[model samples]
Target: MDAILNLRENAARQGEKTLTRPTREEAEAAVRTLLLWAGENPDREGLLDTPKRVAKSYGELFSGYNESPEEVLGTTFEEVSGYNDPVLVKDIPFFSHCEHHMVPIIGKAHIAYLPDDRVVGLSKIGRLVDVFGRRLQTQESITAQIADAMDTILHPRGVAVMIEAEHLCMSMRGVKKQGSTTITTTFRGTYRDDANAQARFMTMIRLG
Candidate 1:
């Protein structure tokens, strides 16, 4: 719960401040250290290049840290033909690493918002999901981040976000419960105040 709150409070802090990062050489050295810790020879013929590969892969996997949600959602179209209904983008495929285990949490996201005066491009919602998913996250954090971004950036009437994911920390380790799934959701504005609106969002996600 504290982690989620910290994430929400810090959501707007990204792209607003300078972030310090390690260089590629430093990252590669860290991977080699991990290999040694795992009882593997870093100098072995086959493993000699493994550190470089892992470092490169980590750059792609965690690139979300370099992206800005405000910039991704900056543009909006007021010419939505006077449309004020809910705009939903469902089943947006995404995979994230669990902050606890740094293992995969594969899932789909369903995002819906009640537009006020304007609407954003549909593709922006998918991009928004990726912006958060490519980071070390808890399912709950991603769910809240999506809803918070839409709510803050678009100033929509309401926002609803649902994420269904399988955490590898639970499936591949800990309890080792394979195939188990977890769902997390965040509702804001009208979706939080009105039961009917929230129910309709659920129905659309289920039927679609």
Candidate 2:
């Protein structure tokens, strides 16, 4: 299990490349180019400020890249009086952009971790979701990253993550299936080994 997790982490690191980020002015100029590509005049009265607005919006939308999951999940509470059960946070609403189309992927994530000794704040779980959700991602990568972060940081007995989202790339473009939703899940350690554990996690999500 550790080896698998290490491989995943290594692969993720290998996939990352350092690139100099563009200045806000440069970003706005790029937005203007995109507007032109979309067959719109950037200098039009109504569109004059659109590039600046888009640049500002992108800063907020992709802020996840500036955050560190280790910082978010590093702190844990060990004061619980032998309380070691599945701690689940469900229906955490998130908005992400698909890596392929840069369109919206609106979804909710359900996360559960069977703690070995310590647990993180419930709100931290929600924040953890945002830490990944605010970046370009696929639902599958988000699901796996959440579960992996929980297992790796908290040293949990198990971790379960389920994300259900509607990808605009598919709904608005390809198939044009407006309401179609995609679901992805990741289970680690005990949840992966025990069917009952997985079932209990699902039950908790459903009951929530």
Candidate 3:
């Protein structure tokens, strides 16, 4: 678990080398380029200020880059009074952008973990979901990331993350399959090894 923590921290530090901070003007210019590519007149009366607005919106939409889930889960209470059981947070609403099309993926995440000697704040679990959900991600990757975060940080006996979402890329275009939903799951430790524990998590979420 310590190695997992160090690996993620090192990865984040290494990832910084490939990134260059662009100025607001540069960001706005890129938006204008997209507008031109989309066949929209950037100088038109209706779209003149659109580039700046879109640039600002992107900052808000992808703010996850500035956050860390491990930090958010950093504070835990060991005074759980020997309550070493599964803690679950279900139907945590989140909105993410699909990396493939840069479109919306609306969903709910159901997260659970069996604590060892420490338990995190319940709201932190929901916030953990939001941190990852705010980034451009695939449903599969995000699900796995959440489970792994819990496993490494809380050192839980097990961790389970299930995400159910509808991607705008699929619903609004492509096959135009409306009402289509995608579900993904990741399990770690006991959740991965024990069938009954897994079944209990599933049943609890279904009842919710």
Candidate 4:
């Protein structure tokens, strides 16, 4: 609960000011250290530029750390008179790196919220996913993050978030099932307390 509150507060703080962190050269040097530690020659013909490439890739992959979904979600339109039904964005695919192993987590997210007055733009839903997805994450934290972000920014009556993903860490190492997927969900407000609302969200996401 405290963690989620911190995230919400952090989201609110975004767009207000910039936060400083490590430099790209420092990140590249770290990656090079990992290469050397992995017993790979960082100076080899093929690997000579690998660190720079990795640094650039890492910039793109974890860029979410520098962004806030609340900024993207801040815009809204209240033209939704008499249309207070739950708004849903389903089968939205995203790519995230697992914080546990720094490997890919390929997934689709299903997001829904029962509106109070206003609604956000459709693409903003995907943008919200990208904002959270570009950071290293666990499925559970990401689930709560999405729903919480929506609840905070949209001030909705309820919010629901479900993420289904295959973690490369699970598939490429450890027990290595190679095909298992993990699903996590978070619900808030009416979605958390209303069974009917929860079932409707599930049914809508599953619709053909």
After the best TM-score superposition of candidate 2, give how far the Cα of residue 128 lies from its true spot, in angstroms.
0.6
**Of candidates 4 and 1, the better by lDDT:** 1
- What's the CA RMSD for each of the models? 5.0, 5.2, 4.4, 5.2
Off by over 4 Å in 2: 1-12, 15-17
lDDT of 3 at 16: 44
Candidate 3, residues 1-208: lDDT per residue as tens digits? Answer: 3334544665687884333467889989999999999998999999999988998898778777667887899999989888987888999999999999999999999998998998899999988888888788999989998988888888988998899999999999999999999999889999999999999999989993
Compute the lDDT of residue 18 as modeled in candidate 3.
36
Cα lDDT tens digits, model 4, 1-208, are: 3334545566667854433455778878998899999999999999989989998888788777667777899999988876889999999999999888999999999999988988999999998999899988999989998998999889999999999999999999999988899989889999999999999999998998
Q: List TM-scores for all candidates, in order.
A: 0.90, 0.92, 0.90, 0.88
TM-score of 1: 0.90
In every candidate, how many clashes are there? 0, 0, 0, 0
Candidate 1: worst-modelled 10 consecutive residues by lDDT: 1-10
Tens-place lDDT per residue, model 2, 1-208, is: 3323544565678895434456789989999999999999999999999988998898789877767789899899999999988888899999999999999999899999888988899999999999899988988899999988888888999999999999999999988999988989889999999999999988988992
Q: Number of the top candidate by TM-score?
A: 2
Model 2 TM-score is 0.92
Give the Cα error of residue 13 in candidate 1, in Å: 6.8
Reference-based TM-score, model 3: 0.90
